[model samples]
Target: MKILLLLLTVSVVMAQAQAPHIDSSYSDGQIQAFLKDGFERNDRLLQAKAYYLLAAREQNGGINNEYTITYLQKSHELFAASRDAYHLHRAKLALALSYVDQKTFDQAFDLQREALTYFEQRNDLFMATHAAASLANTYKLMGNLPQERVYLERCETNNKLLKDNILSLAILNSKVVNFQRQRQYDQALSAAHQLLTIARASKKTNFEIAGLFFEGILHQFKGQYQTAIGKLFDCLSLISNPNLSPEAMQCYLHLSQCYEALHDYPHAYQYSQRYGQASHAILNNQRQTALQRQTLRFDAEGKRRQIANLEKEKREAEQTALWQRTITIGIGIAAFVLFCALFSVLYFHRQKTRSDQIIENQKEEIKQKEINELRQELTLQNVQAIVTGQETERERIAKDLHDSLGGMLSTVRLRFDALKTGQPTHAYEQALDMLDNTIREVRHIAHNLQPDALLQFGLTAAINDLVNRTHSPATPDINFQTYGQEFALTPTQSLTIFRIIQELLYNAIKHAKASEILVQLNWQTPSLMILVEDDGVGYDTTQIQTGMGTKNIQTRVAYLNAHLEVQSVPDEGTTVVVTVGV
Candidate 1:
């Protein structure tokens, strides 16, 4: 994580030095259609964001505003369904802002309230403050200052709670603009100063530019020409900071107004020309990109449809040719009359050979059937051995509980009965202690005999218990990783793998004396792969004869029609790989 941050910082600095701009091309209608299909085909999150942001840009451009709201709403629902609360709030806020633009104040207010609830519930004050400010702005637009003031105070309070002065500046700037609309110069000037102070500390040059703009407006209102001009141009210089295009253009237009106010006719004319040209070029580039994107999308869709129709036509032509060939095949059959007689005799002879082979296969199958039955018997016996051991253990615990604990507890209960209620002795307490321990031991034994947790949990928990019981506190590291998906094998498959793993582990613990062992099982498409590897003094492959254990391993694989590979050296290590068809 630390290394990634350092690398990201270096990349950002280098990219900034290059001043590379991302002029993205996108079709309005075609992008909408593609994104709609993207959700319909497989409603994934990145696709939802893809459509939502596309619609947002369209709304921002004042094109297809209604449809953009619909897309944004749909994207918000998708994000909510995916449980991405952050993005869900973002999309809802965008939709609300769009509604505000369309003068649907009631709907915008409701959406913003909902968005605020999401942010507030998660204690995300940054987003919460934004939502609050948006609500306040809606109230102001409706000419309700009392409600607007309440929401504005809330926004500021939340911003303070978050200690985000940048958000504070943004909110105050919004309020100053509202005050300016009411011709409240004193209030506007105060708010704008607060905004400027916070904005300078923000370190975001773009935002500081906004702060300076508001300050310049305040100064121009007061007829302070020189100071405002210097401050405005200082803000303008930051316009080429490699992250300022839209703001830069806006700043230039506002600066022309400032120049016009000072009655500098020539300077005003120059500033106005620059503003018009820059705005025109930006809009022109946006339109051309949109056109190119639309053309490419239409051409691609047309080509796809044409290819599909051609394929259908080709298939129909092939079918027609096939019917014609069928008619010609009748004539060819008659022409080969002499060859048919020789082919029949050869075919009959081959059929006889096949019949013999089938008989041989049936005999071999019966032999394999008997071997399978024998293998099943051996596997059952192994299971029975473990079960028998558990039964013996249970009997021993039951005896101790009944003979030792039960007798001692009975004696303790008699001692308690003999004691007066007001004159209980320390001996009575000792007897109580022994009685409690006895009861606990009995319960422990019962729990060990029948581990209810095994049924409640799963094979993993069961293995964990077995591992804790058999191994010491500190032993060789055990690595167990399940790949793909977890699954319960059929009884037969489970038994085979379990017994194989047990035998391998037993060898590692008792004979091989290995320090480390690794067992892995991976479930892949239509197959499963099991691998067991150990770093130990492995046996020589040539020296390994078909012992009882070796036969058991090979036979188990054979029964499952699985391929098993064993690789080992005299001293290095050993690895067992098994692949079974699902």
Candidate 2:
């Protein structure tokens, strides 16, 4: 009987091991069947192996975090209970990964450290190095740069000790990320080049793609946009699963940024849209996984309850049979009790089904809401871009009017004065009068479009002129104040800021009907702050619509890459503040 039990256990273990195929193409149904079979066998090693396989498969399939963590936890417990050191460490490592996926960095780090310690104690250099690498990754995620570097160094040391180039390649990959995070571009580039060379030497497609992606990122950081684009495209071309792979998503994002940097706005927008879609898809997948996890947990609990009740019924029936062996009525009573138990089970099962259906409906509603929100956000961004473009064109037209039309008119006036003698014809005098009026109008229009003071004399003079011009007997008592030293700014920055101030003043006068307005400009060496305040009937900010003037102000603020704050309340004065890097 002992030999037979040993043989049966071995068979079960082997069967469990063979159940979940390692092939990437294996179906989820097959994996579920294997897990069910192994679990039903109730052998420790077999169950542990089955759990590990399920975790691995779920991870590869991008299934929800709960299931992965559940399987890993189960596997860890079984492996530890069975005293299987090798498999226990594997289970711990897998558990650490699940923790990482769930962003539980502290837990991940602890588990990885335990695995590392175990491997080192066993002199398992290969797994020890891998564990060290994982620890490094967890540290990176935790934003502990120094600690990350420390573990990475340890990983390199072990890899070198093992004389394993492939293991060392992983170290190099981590170095690229580490150096990139530190903004050590030269070091990052060198590491990426080395990684590419090694990956090519290994002739591994995935590693090669990863190397290219890293190189692309390094080039992008170095401002070699075109070269970065080339490398990223090469990486993309080799990517088999763009939606599922983090690297591919990163590639899409980097490509978008690279195109934007190159001034290829159309392509940039296209890639950016793709990046957004891919990100949304990933998030949706995570949400679905979370929901699935909840469903699974519910189902498991329901099964446990069913099993417990059934066991109780069986015990009761056995007791009844013992008491009623001589009485046939006792058999009837047991049968009736069993029927009642079955009915209760069925009723509870129906309730569980209804609950599941409700949860699924809620999940669907949340998913739809998220999708709609994402769509609306994308639409807003697109509209904002168009508005920005329109503002840019207005600035350009204003500059053209000031430089070309205004200059031409001034030239003509100069010629007319030169040609004038002691007496002038009535038509020539009328023409001169018309010309004067036209010149004034042209100047006014040009100033409205793009302020000359902003372009020529910088922000301080421009703002002072704006306040002075806007202040009159009929208008608000506008006060202009300046603090700190005035500094030079790029034309684009100056115009954007000027436009923002103009919009704020215009809004205050037209909408707020203010009695007094204060405009303040403060220039600290590397930054500028603009404050505009008005004592007027302020409207509710939440009720403010995205009108052209408001949109223009927003566009200009964005163009300057500045922070804008608008505070207003009914019956309270409005205040607008802007801050920008100088």
Candidate 3:
């Protein structure tokens, strides 16, 4: 716990030292599309901005990986080439921050200083304040508190000129950490109070929670256990879902310590148990997420290889045809020129040319036929994959029932028989527990196969049921909205669409790590549009060809001749839109 608290303080300091940027209105895919258009139009400024947006998207994804640095570098070069000094310096500041994240302090320090000077000279306090904050963060990481404080002061001065509460909030957060690190509880407490006031005024729940937690820690350090407990409780209450929040865990941990310090063993034990449960839940979630990612990666690799093979074959065939046509055309032109002076030879050449044209038409038809056949083969394969996946799922459920439930029932029967012959106390209770677990497993399997609401009510009811079942404290909040009137569809069509939405929601919850999800359905005459959007960690669509869930969705979409579009930006989120003829 001592080590945990020490690490917590350092992490809090680092986290609060940097200013948080607003989420981008556009997704990564949308930006990439814009970038492609810009390149085609030879718009250097647009290209530079797009590159910078990509860099910011990468930063929002929580790391300074190679892609982030490369994008920023590209953006910087383009801005310089376009002679856009304002944006060029902005790019330099971003690059400096990226370097800081990479822990390349030397480069970060130099670039940050240069950008800060530029912004200050131009009287751009907004950018200048950010530049100062970043430099301070770098210094903080390098363990130079005095120098860190100096730049932090610089940030405060610029922020005063700008009068931005968001900027002030960031500065105070770092101040709390700095003061606490220096063992100055009074100053730290003051900063914490200021942070709490600004956060509450802005209605930023997360920052408010952070401020309360900081105050609790400061109070605890000053040996005011009762006061600390109150502050921690307030922090815990502000969290919408305690079980799903790391903040809740922090509060529980500190509350337990505060109680223990006061020799209140019962409350301490209670909070300690809650903390343990929260920690275990978090760990399980992390493990499950890691397993899902590994599975997706394996699936994506296989699909990519298959697609590559198909493309290679197509390219080879096209190349062969191109060479054959080129050679024939060259020979035909040469023969025509050589025979132009002789009447009889010219007449023979015209007849041969007519025959050659017929042969070319035949070859073109054959090529078209082959292309059609190839497309048909691809379609058949996708259908087969979907069917095979369904069969696999059925087999898995059958195995679960046969092995797990069957074994449990046999054990229960034996236990009952032994009980009749006189067994140990609580034998009946144990048998009941086993029976209860078996019942729950049976219901779970049945629900996966087909929901009762789907059969009894319809698509809307089933979807509502799904949202209710899938949304939990451990998962993101899912909001289902419908625009226009509901439309009728056959049972099979409804089930297909339901499955597609189900897979999308699963991806958002298990894979995307989304905080919130919105599933909207728009019903129109003879058509329906489905949109699923999530504020989660998005991916570069160009790099990822497909996944198992994506394949499933694609199969269904093809069946209905629907149009599907997916747009995503790293850290910004993902939006999936599907339009189908009802």
Candidate maximizing TM-score: 3
Tens digits of lDDT, candidate 1, 1-582: 111111111121212211211123344444444444444445456455655756655653545455667668877887887888788777777787778778899998888999889889988776777777778877877888767778878877776677655556656766777677777777887887777677667676655766677666666677776767777777777676412266666666767777888788888888788778778778887799788767655654564454345446646766887899998897788768768887889999999999999999999999999999999888867655654564567657767776687667777767767773766578667767777777776755655544444555544454455445446645555666667874665645655555565556656666555788787778787788878778888888788777767776776776666899889986777888889885
TM-score of 2: 0.41
- Give stretches of model 2 more than 4 Å off: 1-43, 54-60, 64-71, 161-166, 233-256, 259-582
Considering summed lDDT, which 10 consecutive residues are worst modelled in model 1? 1-10
Clashes of 1: 0
Pull out the clashing pairs in model 2: none
Task: Assess candidate 2 and give its lDDT.
Answer: 0.77
Instruction: Give TM per candidate.
Output: 0.37, 0.41, 0.46
Who is ahead in TM-score, 1 or 2? 2
Q: Note the residue pairs that clash in candidate 1.
A: none
Give the candidate number with the greatest lDDT: 3
Q: Taking the tens digit of each residue's C-alpha lDDT, what string does model 3 give over 1-582?
A: 111111112122211112222223455446655566556556677777877877675565444467678878988999899999988888887898788778899988888888889988998777777777777788888888778789878877877777767667778888888888888899999999999999999987777988999999899999999999999999988989888688898889999999999999999999999999999888888788768666655654463355345446646766887899999999998898777756677788888999999999999999999999999888877775775577468657756765677667767766776666565658766866777777666755657566668768888789888899888799998999988888788776787788889899998999888889999988887899999999999999889778889988998888777899999999899999999897
- lDDT score of residue 117 within candidate 3: 92
Worst 10 residues of 2 by lDDT: 1-10
Better of 2 and 3 by TM-score: 3
lDDT of 3 at 411: 73
